[model samples]
Target: MCSHTCAPSTLLQRDSISKCSLCLCTWLNPRRWLNLQEYQSKKLMQDSGVAVQRFYVAHTASEALEAAKRLKAKEIVLKAQILAGGRGKGVFDSGLKGGVHLIKDPAVVGELAKKMLGFNLTTKQTPKEGVKVKTVMVAEALDISRETYFAILMDRACNGPVMVGSPQGGMDIEEVAASNPELIFKEVIDIFKGVQDDQALRMAANLGFKGPLQRQAADQIKRLYDLFLKVDATQVEVNPFGETPEGQVVCFDAKINFDDNAEFRQKSVFAMDDMSESDPTEMEAAKWDLKYIGMDGNIACFVNGAGLAMATCDIIDLHGGKPANFLDLGGGVKERQVYEAFKLLTADPKVEAILVNIFGGIVNCAIIANGITKACRELELKVPLVVRLEGTNVHEAKRILTESGLPITAAEDLDDAAKKAVAAIRK
Candidate 1:
């Protein structure tokens, strides 16, 4: 299906077949079908004849500034092209106001762009690479009567996808949910059954949606759901979905997250991946087929299973310490995997100490300890390694670690190991 050198006819046939298969799977998760990039979402909006901001894409900082200079509006948004949320929360604000830069002077745009692009934004969910300023979008800022949230997501409660609307929008939707839950309204849709016009009317009515603006919101919601089904989108959110002074309902900003499995049929969807926003270590881990993620703790943790790896991190937190990274050595892991995991952990500057917790259920502790010993020798790890070995070959594991003469503290239990790791980090 990837037509680098294939015949044109064969490529077209394969592409068509792939599209059909993906469309069939849209029902698999109607709400969470197509995961689109910001650029793609903008493109989709343009295709739908929505009134959106005029924008330009610049791959470099200079180009972004140039685009800003050309725009009629002095305001520009230099977005790092990664698909992550809370970009305006100052992951790399670079003194940009509300994620929108008032380009009063074009001279500062390039400097801001260069600094924000390729920076690191650590969110609670993931540490994303600041979207490289491949393209800066320069647009007119709008004055809004109100900001609201509009999203169509798979509703587990309804056993189908649903459109959720809130009069209260912006970055603080979570706060709104916590403080006032009644303000939010939801409408579930059975994609196969299709959405009824009356249902849209009622939803609009319940939300106190009135006047021309209300009708527009209702229509936009309907159209958004249609796009969701058509594109097989996973999550589509327009936060602070605006009611501008001109009676136009505009999605001032969009955040979309997609399912990778659907990439087979959604060729355009897959093209949305922006590598500029991904961490180098994570990218490298993906390349090596490893499940690894960086964290903000001082203790670099390496465990055998995903569940156990998480438990280890929790225990570390329970003991009043943070985990530097989550590195799962995996079940039935070998010396090579262990060695690579260790290398990845030490590579992180945030990691001040290392914790090797091996349950050795399906994986023998001795193998893990041997890997640790091997990894230490090869990498000459300067950080302290606090290891807890149990289950299979526990004694052998301890012997290997102790004999290595590396800066390793071996514990017989989780509690003791966690304490030691915390103590080591504090020291």
Candidate 2:
């Protein structure tokens, strides 16, 4: 159930915050980047001489149709480029399901491509500026007889890399764990010590792999572990890693997240980043060097502390409301920083109300209040704003808001602020 793995890195931030809590590196640490993009992922597999589908990325529908014709494949897969999971049935459809409209006809393909490119999938991962379909991939579809899960991830318990294999692949792994838990198996590997032959053989035999396929699987396992070390990857998973009738092993789905801090040493890997599928808010935040993750729900939240931001969201959910985003403004904040945070939070149409919960502590509430006033003076601030300011300079902060004529509701505590924000959205 825990797919999240930590990478190793050493980066010195002003706050020295490690982006990936489990990873050795943070984004600040320069290393290669491995984004969860189909094109880039397939390219990695292709470079390693692994068998994967030949695919073309089309920015327009016309290009998709053209590529489809060139490949001479009647059936094709159209996927919206994104890092989110469950694309097919979820908001970001990979178009792997049957009845997916194929571009057999040139005109139809063009139309579909144009439509998809222009459309946005407002999934739970990115409700703000839903993932835009900037480039659609057109690839030959495969008739998979059986699918398996193959992944090499860091095992904290073993303090090394672990290989996970499951005959139950595709769809939800949790469902498989609940229904048939016996099929999934894990093999520990000490990459520095190299994978033991007996361990590899046992893993292969357990997965029912034999003949040439067993050798191939074992080889792939070794290759994957090597790749993990070479790339300093935290996780590498091929879900429903398929098998052709001829026993040909193919990776169908690949999910990878790089140690952001390792970018310095991994320049070549980081160059593969594709921003086409990212949310607009996230892109904007990255441009300003802010840490933010877009989520569903109506209440937009902004806090000076990460821990407080999470607590605010939990309270909102408990009050029968959802949070729009998780934004941490960090410490030693200023008026301009607070203004920028508000701008990004309000940009999303899903945000019906705004919650400003600042404990202040190291930050002065008066400065944040000034920024809130400035945002109200310049931007729309169409949604109601409920604020709670408790730490530094609370009096001046309240005074600034009272004079701003911002129609803002002030609460002395986080509980009161969260409840008021949720109620504001409901009303």
Candidate 3:
């Protein structure tokens, strides 16, 4: 299940039970969006005509201090720039109390940034190893009179877009949805017509804003929706969409995720991607157009399609074997890709055995066989290897493997392949 703030909705039809559970699970998980850091999200919102706090991004401690000086606010806030949430409560490896801080004196901003920059910040949303903070955001701290939650997301239930809001802001929206589902308000928008003015107004009022403030929030909602469409965003979340002591409405914190499919057209937005936050192996796999996800298991899996990859993992687990990774050699795979995928699998110290499950529809089993033999010889692969090839030139593939005389065990079917791989590892 995805940990995104969006409320979960039924994405598959009940009659489609015969469909692959992997496909159904993929649709249900909404964490596929490309996430941007807080400062980047705020900049996008500010540019989209949505009111946001004044802020500056800095890569160094000196720059952080300079940004705080330039703001000249009586009080300033320093935030560690990591992709994950729960930064306010996150702790730094340096024993620093929190990733976020409010300082009365601008002079101390640099000290805090020194503690944050280059240090790992562990948050509930992040892995235990945590993500390193290479950047910091220095912004004017707001004195809020009220707080609210607002977001625009592509909803499967609506079969289009939906606006979600709540007066209970500055809290986990998922927790809010679970504990008090009635407090959350949703307005489904027709993809063709967009968010209507009446709908915005109704949502704004439902968020507990009144009079001019309601209209102002409504206007902000429309602007957010426009930005969502403009940037091809999958989500635009503004938590603590707040009213200040001065009666002005502003977006205090924001998070935005773009659709990966739109990266070509949204070049500028996609360029902001910080590769440092990504898994090194996953990044390497991306270079070869291979889909790889690491897991905590001993058997490495290589399959052709997404559904088949997942099914392979399931079968391995069912046989009391855990998968070390999910490596999907998507359709039209080349020999080089197969070799590269093998390299990634063997590189993992956890992988004691490897399984190749290919039901070649558009892929050539011969290519996979050639790549495997090439890798086994050149790379001196020490792990036990199990091969299961089906469809399209599988006979030729088998002949090649057999003639190569490699120490590879052949399986008759998926179940046999999974069992052999598991038994080999245990031995």
Q: Report the alpha-carbon TM-score of model 2 versus the true structure.
A: 0.71
Measured against the true structure, the TM-scores of the candidates, in listed sequence, are 0.69, 0.71, 0.90
lDDT of each: 0.67, 0.71, 0.85
Candidate 1 lDDT score relative to the true structure: 0.67
**lDDT score, candidate 2:** 0.71
Ranking by lDDT: 3, 2, 1
lDDT digits (tens) for residues 1-427 of candidate 2: 1224311111112222334433433332112134557877777766776677778888876787788777777566777666654455544243323213444554466666666676665555554556666777777777677777777776666777877777777766656554666777877787678777777767766666778877777777677666667777777777777777768767777766566767888788888787655556766765655667677788988887666776787899998889987677777787887778888988888989999888878989899999999998789778899989988899999999998888899997988998999899878
**lDDT tens digits by residue: candidate 1, 40-100:** 6877766665546677766677887787788756455556554555555545535443333
The candidate with the higher TM-score, 1 or 2, is: 2
Please give the clash total of every predicted structure, in order. Answer: 11, 28, 0
Give the poorly placed runs of model 1, Cα more than 4 Å off: 1-37, 44-51, 59-99, 102-132, 140-143, 211-215, 230-232, 330-334, 349-352, 359-370, 389-411, 423-427
Summarize candidate 3's per-residue lDDT along 151-223 as a digit string, tens digits. Answer: 8888765677888899888876767776787888888899999989999999999888898998998999999
Cα error, candidate 1, residue 37 (Å): 6.1
Residue 63, candidate 1: alpha-carbon lDDT? 80
